[model samples]
Structures are given as structure tokens and as C-alpha cells.
Target: MRVKCTVSYDGTGFSGFQIQPGQRTVQGEIERGLKKLHKGQEVKVFASGRTDAGVHAIGQVLHFDTEIYIPESRWPNALNSLLPEDVAIQAAAFIEEDFHARYHVRAKEYRYKVSRSEVRDVFSRNYAYHYPYKLDYVKMREAIKFLIGTHDFTSFCSAKTDKEDRIRTLYDIEFYEEDDVLTFRFVGDGFLYNMVRILVGTLINAGRGVLDPYRIPDILKARDRSLCGKTAPGSGLYLWKVYYDN
Candidate 1:
């Protein structure tokens, strides 16, 4: 049966979601649990996308084929028993044979969190980026206006990325503040390597008065990585949600 599962992880303890030899990865653990369930027979799990080290996720989706015949409702409980504390299966269901967690995704939402308080919260350190610098909220909002819609986001992606077709349709970049915390949510068809984090960093730079908001258009047109700002820390990033056409 084709099984679809939504998993959540703290990410602090994980190297990343992919299977890396000799590394403690989220996929490694999940595959380990699956093997345990299958009496040592290895099973592979496919994720929607890979998140870098220290990146968290609340609704990361994945799929794998299994023949254990466990009910969909009990999949979570069965997997949770074999998984580590940092990772947990939130929900699972038997999906169509053609349903793919990655290729079938129509859209995805990624969120980055920032704490602007002078006093740091130790508890949130592992989950949020502590950036107490003064940010012009109005400027950040204005900068994103240039980001919404389809365009080549080469400047907002890591140079290490090999994907040449950087054109992505950004549905929206939403910003909101709650007291001392700033939340930036990005909705889009897809993202390049570190694209959302780089975009957030560029927007934050605009808010910090280092870059002019109006220059965003030129930056996009430039297609130059040098025009981009610092890449935000991975801790602040989260795979918020994934949407499907079906």
C-alpha cells in the first residue's frame, strides 16, 4: 500500500531530513523505525523536500510503500513507538498509488520567526532567530510587494544550488507581529535552495534601512547573487504546510 504521513520535528537534533551515511538524520530515523517494523527489512521514505540543518517543520509530508498491513489510523502510534523523541508522526493515511508527496504538491507555505525583544527567551532560542535590531515593519511589507508573482529568484537562492530554472511563482509574502515577535510567512508554488531564508534576510535588510525597498525590482532584474543579503539562520525556518490540487 502507498502510505502518506505528515510528520513534525524539532529539527535541533536532526542533521536534516535526507538519508546521509553516518549522520543522524530525520529520514534515517524514520527509515530505521520502518525497518524495525518490518523486522529489519529496509524501507524508504520520500519527503516533499529537504530542509537544512536546524530547520523545523510542523506539517512536513512524506510517503512510502509498505506491506505491513497496519491500519492507517494506527500508523502514527506504531511509528511513534520506534521513532526518537524529536520526531513524531502526526497523521497517516493510505493514499492512491499515483499520489506523490513531492511531485503532487501544488503549493507550499514556509514561515520564519524572529524575536525582536531586548531580553532573549532561552526556550525559544532553538526555535526562533534572536534579532533585536530595529526593523521598519512598514518597509518590510513594502519590499514584499515586489516579490509577489512569478519571477526568477536567483538573487534569493543559495549559490550552491544547481537548479538553473530559478523562476518561481510566489503567491504572497505575509508579515505580522505579535508584541516582540515577527513572523514572515511565504506562500509559493515552490522554492529554491534556501530561497525563503534568503528572501527573508533581504526583506529584513530593507527593514533595517540597509537596502531601499524600491530597489527590490532592480535586484530582481539583476539576477545577481551579490545583490542579496545575508542568509537567515535555519532555526527560524519551518515547513509550515503543503497544499495539493486534489
Candidate 2:
């Protein structure tokens, strides 16, 4: 049977979602728990996508094949018993064998938070990016208008991205502020490596008046990575949700 699971995690303690040779990671820990459940038989887990180090997730989804027939409702507790406190299985269900967590994804939503307070909150230090600089939200919104549709996002992704086709669709980009925290929510069909972080950084620059908001179209047209601003820290980013076609 193939079991699909939705998970949430505090990624501060993880190296990343992917398994790495000596570093602790979310996937590594989950697989470890599954290994124990299967009496050492390896269980490979596939995720919708990978999150960078210090990046959190509220609704990350994964799927794995298993011979065990534990009830779906019990699967969460069964797995949680073996997993660490930072990672959790929120829900599980028996899924069609052909369903894939990654390729079948229709869309994904990500959120990045910026703390505009004079003094950083110690409690949220590992979760939010503290930006003390003044920002012009109006300018930021103007800049985001250019990024609200399908386009080649080459200039807004990491140079390390191996995918040659940089095209992706942004369904929407929303910004809101509450209690000194600025949130940028992005809904897209797909994202390249570090794409959201780079976009956030570029938006921040525009908000700071460091770059003209109207120049966003030129930057996108350039398709040059160097034309974008710094990549925002992963701590401020979250895999908010994933969408699928049933």
C-alpha cells in the first residue's frame, strides 16, 4: 500500500528535508522511524519538494510504499512515537499506488515573514527574519505586480539550480502586515531552488527604495541571477501548503 502523509515541522534543528550523510534532517529522521517500524526494512520517502535548511513547513506532504497494514488513523501515532519532537505526522491515508507526492502537485503556497520591530523577538528568532529598516509597502506591492504571472524566473533563483527550464507560474503574491510582522504569501504552480527567498529579497529592496519598483520587469527580462537582490534567510520561509488534483 502507498501511504500519503501530511507533516509539519520546526526546521530550525534540521539540516534540511533531504537525507545527508552526517547531518540530521527531517527526511532522515522520518525514514529512521519507518525503518524501525518495518524491522529494519528500508522505506524510501518521497516529498512534494525539498526545503532549505532552517526553512519550516506547516503542511508538507510525502508518500511512501509499505507492506504493513496499520490503520491510517493509527499511522500518525505509530510514526510519531518513533519520531522526534520537531517533526510530526499530522495525518495519513492509504493512497492510490500511482499517486506521487511530487509530480502530481498542482500548486504550492509559501509564506515568508519579516519582523519590523525595533527589537527582535527572542522567541521567534529561529522563525522570523528581523528587518529593522523602514519599508514602503506601496512600493513593494507595485514591484510584486510584475511577478504575478507565468514567466522565466531565472533571475530569481539560485545559481546552483540545475534545471535548465526556468519558467514557472505565480498565481498570486500577497502582502500584509500585522503586529509589526510583514508577511509575503506566494502561490505558484512551481518554484525553482531558492526562488521564494530571492523574490523576497528583491521585494525588500524595492520596499526600501533601494530599487525602483518599476524596474522589476527589466530584471525579469534580463534572466540574469546577479540582477536580483540577496536571498532572504531560510528561517523566514515556510512551506505553507500544497495543492493537488484529487
Candidate 3:
């Protein structure tokens, strides 16, 4: 049977989602649990995408094939018993064998938080990016408008990306602030490696008056990674959700 699972994890204690040889990784841990459950047989798990080190997830999705049959409702508890405290199985169900967690994805949502308070919140230091400097939220919102819709996001992606096609569609970009915490919610068909972080960093530049909001269009047209701002820290990023066409 093919089992689809939704999971959440605190990326602080993990190297990343993918399995690394020696480093402690989310995939390695989960697979290890599955191996124990399967009586030493290897169970390969596939995820929707990879999260970089220090990135968290509220609704990450993955799927794996298993020979053992268990009630869908009890799968969580059974897996949780074997998994570590930082990683969790939120939900699990039997999915069609043809369904794919990665290829069948319809959209993804990523949320980034910034701490705007002058005095750093020690508790949230590991969860949010602390930028005490004042930001012109108005200019940042204006810059985001240029980034909406379909476009080649080469300038917003990492130079290490191997994907040749850089075209992607942004369904929406939501910016809001409450109690001095700034939130950026992005929904898109897909994202390139480090694309969202690079965009956030550039938007910060716009907020800082270092780059004019009107220049966003020019930057996109340039297709030059050097023209973009620095990539935001992975700690501030979260994989909020993954959508499927079900």
C-alpha cells in the first residue's frame, strides 16, 4: 500500500529534510523508524520538496510504500512512537499507488517572519529573523506587486540551481504586520532554490530605500543574480503547506 503522510518539524535540530550520509537528517530519522517497523526492511520515503537547514515546516507532505497494513487513524501513533520529539506525523492515509507526493503537487505556501522590535525577543530568536532596523512597509508592498504573476525568476533564484526552466507563477503575495512582527506569505505554483529568500532580501532592500520599488521590474528583466539582494536566513522560512488536486 502507498501511504501519504503530513508532517511538521522543528528544523533547528535537523540538518535538512533529505537524507545525509553522516549528518542527522529528517529523512534519515523517519526512514530509520520505518525500517524498525518493517523488521529491518528498507522503506524509501519521498517528500514534496526539501527544506534547507534551519527551515521549519508546519505542513510538509511525503509518501512511502509499505507492506504492513495498519489502520489509517493509528498510523500516527505507531510512527510517532518510533520518531523523535522534533519530527512528527500529523496525518496519514492510504493513497492511490499512482499518486505522487512531489510530482502531483498543485501549489505550495511558504511563510517568513521578521522580528521588527528594537529589543530582540530571546524566545523567538530561533524562529524569526531579527531586523531591528526600520523598514518602509509601503515600499516593500509596492515592490511585491512587480513580482506577482508569471515571470522568469532567475534573478531571485540561487546560482546553484540546476533547473533550466525558471518560469513560475505567483498566485499571491500577502504582507501584513501585527505587534511588530512582519509576515510574508507567498503562494506559488512552485519555487526555485532559495527563490523566496532572495525575494525577501530584495524586498528588504526596497524597504530600506536601497532599491526603489519601481526598479523591481528592471531587476526582473535583467536576469542577473548579482542585481538581487542577499538571501534571507533559512531560520525565518517555514513550509506552511502543500496543496494537491484531490
Candidate 4:
């Protein structure tokens, strides 16, 4: 049997989602929990996407092939009992044998948070980008308008990315502020390495008057990493959701 699991985690304590030798990671922890349940049986879990270090996820989807037939109602309790507090299994159910968490993904949503305040809150320092500059929300929104729809996002990706096709369809990009918290939300078909962080950095630059709102079109046309702002901190990003068609 194959099982699909929806998980949520605070990534502050882990290296990242993927497992690496001698490094604490989300996959490693989850696999450990599975091992405990299955009497040391190693099961490989597949995730919808790999999040960078210090990045979080509210609805990360993963799947594993297992012969152990446990009731879905007991999955949460069973997994949580063996897993650490930072990682939690929200739901689990039987999935089609051929279903893949990564390949079948239809869309993904990521949000980058910024604390736009004069004084920073120590509690939120781990989850938000603290910027002391006064940001023009209107300008940021205007710049985001240029990001929606399909385009070559080469300029917004890390130079180290090996992806040959830089084209990606961004369903939406929006910014909103509530109190001292500013949220940048992006929904897209897929993202390249460090793509979201770089996008947020560019938007932040636009908000801080460093980049003109109208310059976004030119930036997209350039398709060069030098044309975009630096990649934002990984701590400020979260995998908000993933969508799948059937």
C-alpha cells in the first residue's frame, strides 16, 4: 500500500526537508519516526518540494510506499508519538500506487513575511524579515503586477540552478500588510532554486525606492541574475500550500 501524508513543521531546527548525511533534516526525522513504528524498517518518503534551510511549511505533502496497514485515524497519533514536536503529521490516507508528490503537483504557494517596524520583535525574528526602511506598499503592489502570468524567471533564480528551462507560470503575486507584518504571497506552477527568496528581495528593493516599479518588465526581459536583487533570507519563507489536480 502507498500512503500520502500532509505535514506541517517549524523548520527553525532542521537543516532542510531532504535528508543529508550527519545533518538533521525533516525527511530524516520523519523516516526515523517511521522506523520506530515499523520496527526499523526503512521507508523512503517523497515530498512535493525541497525547502531550504530555515524555511517552513504549513501543508507539505509527501508519500511513501508501505505494506503496513494501519488505520488512517491512528496515523497522526502513531507518527506524532515517534516524531519530535517541531514536525507533525496532519493527515494520512491511502494513495494510488502511481501517485507522486513532486511530479504530479499542479501548483504551489509560498509566502515570505517581513516585519516592517522601527523596533523588531525578538519572538518573530526567526519567522520574519526585519526591515527598518519605510516601504511603499503601493509601489510593491505595482511591481508585483508585472510578475503574474508566464515568463522566464531566470533573473529571479539562483545562478547555481541547473534547470535549463527558466519559464514558469506565476498564477499570482500579491502583498498585504497587517499591523507590523507584511506578507508577500506567490502562487506558481513551479519554482527554481532560491526563486521565491530572490523575488521577495526584488520586491523589497522596489518597496524601499531602490528599484522603480516600472523597471520590472525590463528586469524580466533581461533574464540575467545581475538584474535582480539579492536572495532574501531563507528564514522568512514558508511553503504555504500545494495544489494537485486529482
Model 2: which residue pairs collide? none
Best-to-worst lDDT order: 2, 3, 1, 4
> What's each prediction's TM-score?
0.98, 0.98, 0.98, 0.97
Stretches of candidate 3 above 4 Å error? Answer: none
Q: What is the lDDT of candidate 1?
A: 0.93
Q: Is candidate 1 or candidate 3 better by lDDT?
A: 3
Which 10 consecutive positions of candidate 2 have the poorest summed lDDT?
115-124
Error of 1 at 194 (Å): 0.7
Across 77-188, the per-residue lDDT of candidate 4 in tens digits comes to 8889999999999998888999999999999999999987889889788899898788888888888889899999999999999999999999999878898898989999
Look at candidate 4 and give me any clashing residue pairs: none
lDDT by residue for model 2 (92-177), tens: 99999999999999999999999889988887799899998999889998998999999999999999999989999999999899
Once fitted onto the true fold, the runs of candidate 2 whose alpha carbons sit more than 4 angstroms away are: none
What lDDT is reached at residue 42 by model 3?
A: 98
Worst ten in a row by lDDT for model 4: 66-75
lDDT against the true structure, each candidate: 0.93, 0.96, 0.94, 0.92
- Backbone Cα, N, C clashes tallied per candidate: 0, 0, 0, 0
